[model samples]
Target: MKVVIIFNHPYEGSYCNAILKSTLLGLQIANHQVDVIHLDKENFNPVMRSEDLRAFINKNPIDEKVIEFGDRLKDAEHLIFIFPIWWELMPALMKGFIDKVIFPGVAYDYVNASNTKMKPLWDKVKGITVITTMNTPSILYNWIFGNAIQKALLRGTFWKLGYKNRKWISLNRVKMVSPEKRKKWLTNIESNFSKLK
Candidate 1:
């Protein structure tokens, strides 16, 4: 399987980076071809300019990086997103990647005459897994905050794009969690990914 991991973290010592490392180890053990899109290292621009909006309206992308990312994801068998939740939402660069790379001509297309209905274009993509870390407690994030990440990414974006096998692995209260618990999470993540086929 060709797995694509979209990783977003500015600091090298961040927990998200640790998650990326564990995920890579797992994919390697599984012998899957993996591609990591390190948004912070690449300095991906999350802000959409007027030109980008215009291109989107035309169903075309002018940014070379966006086009390149789209091409990389064109034949992906599985997509894994690793990031931290800031203010109960995804980081800016990850959001920007979605806004720019996961566009109409790249991820899906409208099938109806009114352009209201969409069908996915990435036929090889079987599933999407999102791993998020946050300082907030999981219960609060889910009950009070409404699991915005899942609703926005899984339901709003991927499900609407025609892919339904979506999963979210949310590690909450990272700052408050015990070191042993964090280590356990990393080990489990690595083991689970290694089991992927």
Candidate 2:
């Protein structure tokens, strides 16, 4: 399968980076072709400008970066997102990617004449895996925050786009954990992802 991994983290040595590396290793073990998008490293502009809004509203391509990312999404069969939860939500860059790349004409199209219903365009995509890390406990993140990231991505985005096999893996209390525990998490991520079809 062709897998596209979107990584959002400013620090190269951060735990999120380790998770991304482990995920790549696992995908390689599965013999899956992988394409990685490092948002920060690419200096991706998270802000949606006036021209971007115009293009989006007009159902035209937003920009070159968005077009490139959209093309990658179009070709991929699996999508993986790795990032750290900041302030109980995803970083602005990732959110911006969603806003910019998943445009009207690219990710979906209106189904009804009234435009009340819609259909997914990227029918090639089968599964989506979101890996997130946070300093809060898992229960608190889920119960208190209502798993905002998962809701936004899975329910609000992919589910609406006809993706069903969506999985969310949250590594909670990351800062409070020991190095050994972190290592174990990496191993677990690799083992689990290696089994992905």
Candidate 3:
């Protein structure tokens, strides 16, 4: 499988980084080809400029970065997103990636003669998995916050793009978890990813 892992975190030593490493290890053990996009390290611009919006509207190439990211996404069969849930949402960088890269011609196409319908272009993509960590309790985040990331990504984006097999793994109360528990979580992530085929 060709997997593209999008990682959004500023610190290299954070638990999110550990999760990324574990995920890579598991994918490697399964002999899957993997590519990683580290938004912070790449200094990805999260702000969408007016020119970008205009180009997108005109069906023109937005920029080189978006084109490159879109190419990676185009080639991948599986997509994995690793990030921390901040205030019930993903960071601005990840959101910007979605806005800029998953544009009209890339991820979906407007159905001709229909303003409300779109046909998904990423038909080669089999599945999408989102791994998120939060400082809040799982139940509270799910019930109170309505699992914002899951709903937004799975329902709003992936499903709208025509992908059906999606999984969301949320690690809650991350700040309160002990080192041992964190390690165990890493093991679980590795085990889960290793089974992907």
Worst 10 residues of 3 by lDDT: 113-122
Pairs with steric clashes in candidate 1: none
lDDT of predicted model 3: 0.87
- Pairs in steric clash, model 3: none
Please give each candidate's TM-score: 0.97, 0.95, 0.95
| Stronger candidate by lDDT (2 vs 3) | 2
Stretches > 4 Å off in candidate 3: none
In order, the Cα lDDT scores of the candidates are 0.90, 0.88, 0.87
Question: 28-126 in candidate 2: lDDT tens per residue?
Answer: 999999999999987678788999888876778757888788777788888999999999999999999888877888888888778767687787888
Score residue 36 of candidate 2 by CA lDDT.
95
Kindly report which residue stretches of model 2 are placed more than 4 angstroms away from their true locations once superposed.
none
Question: In candidate 1, what residue range of length 10 has the lowest lDDT sum?
Answer: 40-49
Q: What number of backbone clashes does candidate 3 have, counting pairs of residues 3 or more apart or in separate chains?
A: 0
Name model 1 segments beyond 4 Å from true. none
Q: Which is better, 1 or 2, measured by lDDT?
A: 1
Give a tens-digit lDDT track for model 1, residues 1-197.
99999999999999999999999999999999999999987767788899998988788988888888888889899999999999999988999998888888877788987999998888899889999999998889989999899888998998888887888899989999999999999999999999987
